[model samples]
Target: MSGVGKSTVLRELGLRGLEVVDTDDPGWIEVVDGEPLWRLPRVTSLLDRPRDRPVVVQGTVANQGALYHRFDAVVLLTAPRAVVLQRIRSRTTNSYGKAPAELARIEQDLRDVEPLLRAGATHVVDTSAPLPEVVLAVERIARGA
Candidate 1:
């Protein structure tokens, strides 16, 4: 999912005046027991407060599932394996999938993890579409459309 256009789309949404949070940003995630997880208190407090508009947050991690009930929509952004790997290789925003091991891990996740995410998703959008279409679809989801 790293290359499925989450950050780019989130930036576009922010430009359009939507509230967006990329939990991959620092201070949002912490490693515990060798796994990266969202900082519970911070995210919980964030969702606890009322807001004029929906806050669309992008993240892919094991522990996030526990908070799904608090969200209005659980969306999974997906792309084909080749597209995902290619985007990962070229992306400048993050260096996650550059290494051989990381790419392999991502490939594994694609096979093992993504399906579970799909099953739980209220909506699933394929990012192989044009960027505008992907962005629009996600924006609509964020807006509760």
Candidate 2:
């Protein structure tokens, strides 16, 4: 999610009239409704009693099979390792993880998450191109527009 621009694409879709659910924000935590909740257990309760809405959920977290099963589709974004490293470098100047080890750890996380992408994700977006291109790809995948 950090390197992938999932939220950016989702926001673009929202602008085009697609209702979206961004679980990356903490506020989503307050809205859980049902059983077999989202990967975040609290979200399960939210699902049990969901509000009247058409939404696409997006986030990166461990153990999300529950949400994965519930969603009509899942989008996983990935970019070339060098591009991702550059993105992290350019965008995270003010972050606490500015040191070499921290950056290395972030790259490691990306590598470690690769298997999960292969195993669980339904659609994978290769985000090595421009943002608009990535958003366009996701829009096609999610909105078919």
Point to the candidate with the largest TM-score: 1
Predicted structure with the largest lDDT when compared to the true one: 1
Candidate 2 error regions (>4 Å): 28-42, 45-54, 92-97
TM-score of 2: 0.74
Error of 2 at 113 (Å): 1.3
lDDT of each: 0.90, 0.67
Residue 129 error, candidate 1, Å:
0.5
Residue-pair clash count for candidate 1: 0
lDDT value, residue 109 of candidate 1? 92
Show model 1 residue runs off by greater than 4 Å.
none
lDDT of 1 by residue, 70-116 (tens): 89999999999999988998888789988899888899999999999
